[model samples]
Target chain A: MRRILSSVTDGRGFDILLVSITMIFLLALSGMPLVYNVVMSFQEVDMFNLNTFSRPYAGLENYREVVSQPEFGLILKNTAFFVFGSIAGQFVLGFALAMFFMMRFPFAATIRGVFLVSWVMPGLVVGALWGWILAGDFGVLNAILKGIGVIDSTMFWKSDPRLSIWAVTIANIWLGLAFNMMLLSVGLAAIPRDLYEAAELDGANGWHRFTTMTLPMMRSTIGAVLALGLIYTLQQFDLFPAITEGGPANSSNVAQYWAWQYSFLLFDFAKGATVSVMMLGFVLIASIVYVWSTRHEVRG
Target chain B: MTPQIEIASVDKHYGAYHALKDINLTIPRGAFTALVGPSGCGKSTLLRSIAGLESITSGNLRIAGTEMSGVPPRKRDVAMVFQSYALYPHMNVLGNLTYSLRFKGFNKEQARKKADEVAQVIGLTELLERYPRELSGGQRQRVAMGRAIICEPKAFLFDEPLSNLDAALRVHMRMEIRALHDRLGATSVYVTHDQVEAMTMADHVVVMRAGVIEQQGAPLELYDNPANKFVAGFIGSPAMNFLDATVAEDGRSARLEIAGKPVLPLARTLQPGREVTVGLRPEHLRIDTAAPRLQVPVRVVESTGSLTYSTTETEPELMIVEQGRGRYRAGETLPLTIAPEDIHLFDPTSGTAL
Candidate 1:
């Protein structure tokens, strides 16, 4: 008893205890829900039997019905577009901004710090703000686009079927931009300044230096940023309801928002669990990629 | 022959703090020059300015025969081996050595051949496929040098490149670097704070202090006839000792004010009754009982098998370094003498060689 108590207080046992606590928490909160969702998807679930653990096994019925739904193809396409569009836009713009702020100028750090406001603000707040700016008639974005002669008429972002999905993507890119930039900035700062000087003396110009030094050194950071972006974009739900609500005939409805609709509004619990299980596969792949990239982070 | 690099009236400023004052230097086509000073003496700033890494506030910098003003580092055709080695962690040894050649449009076969040859010279032949992180500190240093020499650059600049190695490796690499410089006959500029490194590795040594060159010449030239008291004090290993003195009425000798009023003979006639500071190298002072010059008691004695270093118990303690093991102990009085030619006199107020 004394040995066990001592170990728990100050030895390897303490480490194990710390780890098990997190494991228990995750199992109770996240792992159990995931297993339950998968189990519920493979069983016949109804509003009357929702409180019970035992259910009739309905192999592939929920999956088949969910996949055969009329709006499934459209929602899947919208999800793909939103994930890729948001990731691409956020990464490119964030990387550009990170590199720009690396230049020596007064208030450069201060201005970069201000860009983090978007990341810290609640998702609903950001969505509302972007919705206002992306409004069809009185929006600042349209006013500027029209003034610059790029648009003959105002863009109806939320109402149009083709543009409704894009409206949510635009807001997501803004919401995630600061996080991508901050991570990239930390990665950029980790590179020793002497490496750039050495490259300069080795006959490498600005462009060559970037390709050879900056890009290669940032490989791990870029991997982590993209993987996290994919997961985060997949999980985005607040902006959907605030802006288009996956609306205008399900044109903008992504898998996550659609799953929520099936469970709550449409009262189809099995289909909701089925759709969520599919998203869990993508998040798992992204998590693996994130771990693999960071494994080789120790530089010379 | 015209110098390979020439800098005339160069000045550097960081906002209001002046870093490099009007500095003029000339590097010959195949000379190995070292810029050596204590920390914050602008030795590094000057070297960076020469490499075009740091822009000079006002100067005419000429490399070979071309004006280097407003020119970037890549176009200057000069290579630098940084103290940090600065090897690309992502690339293997071969890639690092051949990086510049690739930029210069060399094909894979040609670049690989060049890298192999350079690798062989630096004894990195078997480590070609290994990344920088896999190599030891000394190996990384050699790779940095190999990368610098592969391009056949007009000049080589080293910023304390051997400082990161262990003491034994540092000594070995010092001769290796000098040998490489001789074989290539490349014009090189090295920077170091250790005077010994500058003395051993460089053909011409430029000693700097506070953004100004105190002296520049051959190593022995600076040692034998230092231009100022600072150079005299800085050039030697254990440092030269300075004592308060006054020229005697005889005008041929000076009275050293120590424990005993010892009159030491001078190499040159000085102004009568002139106050001066006398400099004596520790190696030159010897314990002489037969012909005692100054009588002082020993405070401490340290022996290192080959030599003895002792300090005298006096108001202004004088250090003495002598060959062979010394049996002297603390509080033991001993007579010391130095040859008249070995005595150096400096102006007390200006610390200049008189």
Candidate 2:
């Protein structure tokens, strides 16, 4: 006992003790739930069986039922569109803003810091704010577009099936932009200034320098940002309820919101767990990419 | 010879602080000029301005007799070797060497051929496929030089390119760079804080202090006849010793303010009873027991195998360097003599040579 106590207080034993504590906490909180969810997807999980860990096995039935649903293909397509659209919008705009703020002007850093407000605000709150802005008739976006002569009629963002998914995607893009910019700014700042100067003296023009120096130096950072963006966009659910509620004939219903609808509204725990387990595969790939890119940082 | 680079009345201001003030310099074609000073003396700033990496606030800059004011660095046709080497980390050795060729619209085959020739010239033939991080410091430095020379730009700018290397490698690279310059007959401007590098590597050395050129001339000329007290102190290692003195009423001899107040004859006449600063190089001061000289107690005696250096016990200590091993010990009194012609006189207040 004394040896264990002393080891916990000093030496490599202490390091192992701390690591094992974290490992145990992660296993109990994250690992156990993931395994349980996967197990629930393979079992007949009704209300009576939900309270118990031991349930009758029904392998692949939940997956087959979930896949055969009329809305399954629509939800999968919406999820793909949401993930790719939100990521593309967030990354390009965020990178441009990061580069803009990198210029040595007064209040550049302070202004860039102010941009973190979007990232810091609760996603539900941002969704609520964007909900009003994206309203069809009285929203600020329609008003601005009307004022700019880009549109003469109301474009129903939430009610119309075609625009409802786009409304949530736009809101999610705004929500994720600040995060992408901050991470990319860190990557940009890591590049030594002398490299640019040397490239300039090497007879590279502005566009050439961007292609040769800035882009190449930011490879790992770009990879991490994109991978994280994919994971974050896939996890997004608050914006859908606030803006579109995945409704208007379920045109905006993505996999995450559909999973919630299955478990809570319809009480189909098996189908919900099955959908979430499928999402785990995508998130797993994204996490691997994030880790690999971050590990491959090319610093001198 | 026509000047390769010419600057007239150049000034640089960073908001309220003046960096380079009213600078004028001319680099003759094929001559290697060194801009050398202590840190923050604008040597690097001047080199950057020459490379068009920095813009002069208000000055006329001409490269090869063409005005370069308001021209971008890409259009300036000059190459620079930065102190950090700045070899593109993502690119291999050949890629780094061929990067500029791509901007010149060279095809892949031509670019690779040029890279091959330059790699051989810099002795990086075997390492063409390796990245910059894989190379050693000396190898990276050679790659930087090769990158600069591959384009055959009109002028080359080096911003303390060898300061990062080990001492032995620095010496080796120094000769390699000089030999490369001679082989190319390229107009080069090198910036360094080390006066030894300036003296040995450059035909013309420009000494700067506080945003102004203190003196610029041939290396031996600056050493033999420094224009000011700062240049004299800065040009030599184990810097020149300065002593307070007052010229005698005869104007031909000066009384040094040491323990005994020894009187030493001057090589040139100066205003009688004027206060002056006596500048004496350590190498110029010698040990002579038979001559009339100042006797002072030795404080420390340090010797390398071929040379010896000793300091005298004075209010402001005096140092002397002699060839061969020193025979003096601490606490021993030794008589030191310097040739009258070797003594440099400066106005005490202005630090300007008289």
Candidate 3:
């Protein structure tokens, strides 16, 4: 007993003790739910035996049913649009802002710090805030666009089928922009200032320096940022409920919102788990990319 | 031939701080000039201004007879080897060497061939595919030099490039850099705070202090005939020993304020009874017990196998460096003498050579 106690206090046993605690937490909450969901997807999970783990085996039936839904094709397209659209918009704007703040001007750090307000805000709150800005009639965005003569008629963002998915994507871009900028700014700051000076003396102008030095140095950071952004964009759910609620006849329904709709709104637990399992594959790929890109993070 | 670079009446200011003051310099073609001073003395600032990295507040700059005022660093076409080496961490050695050629419109194959030639010259042919993080410090320094020489710009600027290496490597690289400059016949402007480095490497040395050019001339000219007391004190190692003195009534001899007011004969005539400061080089002072000049007790002795450096116990201590092992012990009075021409005199108030 004393040997065990002493080992736990200050030895390899202490390391094992700390690791097992985190393992138990992860297994009980995350591992168990994932296994149960995967198992439930392969079984007949109807309202009759909803509370039981054992059920009549229905291998591939739920998968086929989920894939055969009439809205499957549209949801798949909308999810693709939302994911790629949000990632592109956020990354471009975020990288631009990161470079802008790197200039030597007064209040650069203070203003960059204020950009974190968008990051700290809850997703639902940001969605509501963007909802008002993207509203059909009194929205500031539409007013400005009309004022600039880009449009004569109002852009009915959340209500129209063509713009419903786009509304959530725009909100997500605003919500994710600050986080992307912060990570990119850290990467930019990690680059030595002398590199730019040396390049300039080596007969390189601004654009050449950027293409040759800045972009190549930022490769790993950009990879990690894009991968994390993909995983985060796929898991986005609060913006959907707060803005369009995946409405306009399921025009803006992404895979995550569609999975929620399957299990809760329609009470089809099997289809819900099957839809989420498909997303898990994508998230797993993104996780692998994030890990791989960070392999060079410990460089001198 | 016209000078390679000329700065006439240049000045630089950072808000209220005047960094370079009324600087004027001329770099002849193929001359290796060294700008040397203590830290924050504007030597590096002047080097950067010549490279167009920092703009001068008011003055004209010329590079190879072309007016360089308001010109950017890239347009100036002068490459610099930074002290940090600043190799691109992501690129291999060959990529770093060829980056400038690519921007200058060289095709990939042509640039690669040029890189191979330069890499062979710099002895980096074996390390072509190694990233900067994989190379040793000396190899990285060689790559920086290779990058600078590949462009074949108008001139080369080196900002204390060997300061990061260990002592043995620093000495070795110093000779290597000088040899490279000679072989290329490049007009190179080097900056350092070490007076020994400036004296040993540069044919023309410019000494600066507090943003002003204290002196500029050939290394031996500055050493043999320093323009002022600051130059006199700065140009030599174990630094020139200074002592308070006044010219005697005869005007050809001065009384040094060591012990007993010993008289030191002057090389030239001066105003009688004029108060002045005497400068003496350490190596010039010898133990002439046959004809003693000044006597002071020894305070400390340090030996580095070859030479002996000793200090004298005086109000303001005098440091003496002898050629071989010193036989004198501490706390013992030692008689020393210097040659008449080597006894440098300066006006007491102005610190200027008389």
Candidate 4:
């Protein structure tokens, strides 16, 4: 008893004790589920076999079925569009906004904080809000487009096959724009002000300074923002279920939503697990990139 | 010598606070000028104005006899060495030195050739490809200087460039910078709060306080004949000591207000019975019992083998510095004397020379 008490208070015993507690909690909660899903993707899972660990080994059969579906091609294209479109929109607009707010003006911080309102909202709530704004008949966006004479007729955004994926992508961009801008702003602020003055005295114009000094100094930050954006966009599930529901013949369906549809809506648990395991590959790569980029920060 | 940079009635204001007021200075070509002052005294603001980093609210500035009214910092053609060194951490030393040259449309080969020449001049030829984070503080300082030198601008503005280094490095870099200025025959304006650096490095020194130029002249000229008490106290180590006194019956002398009321002759005549402030440099004082001009109890004694520093135990304690170690202990009354010509009298109310 005395040894137990002493071990808890000092030496490697305390370190081992702390590590074991967290390790046990993570293994029981996250690690088991993750391993179970990967195992389920390799087996023939059904409602009858859900309760038991042992299942019939299906091998590559589940992966084959998921890839061979008729809507698979369209969903793959839509997923690529949503991921790249959302990330590109968020990053470009976020960087521009971050640079704009860097000027010395009153209410700058307060106004930038106001920009985070859309991001502060939950994804499902933001999707619902954008759903109304992107509605076919009574949408405010179509009304603005008509009022500005950009379009002569009402345009169906969420229901139209061509525009269904774009509606959700736009809403996701709005949701993540503030996150990107805030992260990039912190990166921009970490740079010393005297560097700009020194560059100015060195005969660098605005464009030259931006390219030579600002861009290179923000390498790690841009990497982190891009890597996280990739992961976040991949895991983006709430918006799909809220706005388009992978509607109009799967034109808006993405990897995460399709995985959910195969598991709960269609009751094809193996195919859902198979689809998610594939996405895990991309997220793992992004995580590695994030860690590596941050480890190599160029700050002096 | 012809003036290289000229400022006429310059003033700077940030909203309601005035930073620099009616400052006029002419920096002659190839002359090294030092702006020395306390913090927030507009010395840095003045230097930045010259660099075009900070815009002057009113007045004309001429560099190389050209008007600089609307010229941006990049177009002003002046290089500044910041106190932080501000080397680009992302770039290697070679990249840093050649960045401005590249902007000026230097081809890759031309830029590399120029970088080589600058690296050789700055003693960083060995570390050309090393990033700033990999270099030590002194090496980074040399990179900043090299970056400034490669451009060969109209003038160089240094904002306390050596303030970040250790004491020994600060002194060594001080001489190296002065030597570089002399060898290049480049016009330079250095700003520092350390008067010793300004005295030793600059041929001309401008002392400023409260947004006003208190005095400007040769380093020793300002040291020997300060226009005001502020300049007098600011321009020397250990600082000049001030004591309140009443002029004696004779207009040429004044009696000290300490315990002994010891009397000393003034350098210049003052009205008899006038209240004046006596300014005596600490180094000018000595222990002279035979001709005792001051009798005060010592408060503290410090010895550094080559010098003795003592403070008197009085309301406004006076500091006395003497060459070499002389026995001095706390609570001991010490008699001191000063030559009549070494005495400085000031008008007590205005803090100006009498």
Best by DockQ: 1
Model 2 DockQ vs. reference: 0.82
Can you tell me which runs of candidate 2 are displaced by over 4 Å? Answer: A1-6
* iRMSD (1 decimal) for each model: 0.7, 1.0, 1.3, 0.9
Lowest-sum lDDT 10-residue window in model 3 chain A: A291-300
Question: What is the model-wide C-alpha lDDT for candidate 4?
Answer: 0.92
Q: Which is the winner by DockQ between candidate 2 and candidate 3?
A: 2
Which lDDT tens digits does candidate 2 get at residues B1-354? 889999999999888889999999999999999999999999998888887878889988999999998888888999999999989998999999998888898999999999999988889999999999999999999999999999999999999999999999999999999999999999999999999999999999999988899999999999999999999999988899999999999999899998899988999898899999999899998899898478889999999969999998997999989999987888998888889999999989999999
Global lDDT of each model?
0.93, 0.92, 0.93, 0.92
Q: What is candidate 1's lDDT per residue for A110-197, written digit by digit as tens?
A: 9999999999999999889988988998988889999999999889988899888889999999999999999999999999999999
What does the TM-score come to for chain B in model 1? Answer: 0.98
lDDT string for model 4 (A1-300, tens) is 989888889967999989999999999998998999999999999899998999999999999998999998888899889989999999999999999999989999999999999888999999999999999899999999999999998889999999999999999999999999999999999999999999888888899889988898899999999999999999999999899999988989999999999999999999999999988998899999999999967577
DockQ each: 0.85, 0.82, 0.70, 0.82
lDDT of 3 at B280: 93
Clashing pairs in 1: none
**TM per candidate:** 0.98, 0.98, 0.96, 0.98
lDDT of 3 by residue, B1-354 (tens): 569999999999999999999999999999999999999999999999998889899999999999998999989989999999999888899989998897799999999999999998889999999999999999999999999999998999999998999999999999999999999999999999999999999999999999999999999999988889999999999799998999999999999877788899999999998899999999899887889888889999999979999899887889988877988989988888988998999888899899
> Comparing candidate 2 with candidate 3, which one achieves the higher TM-score?
2
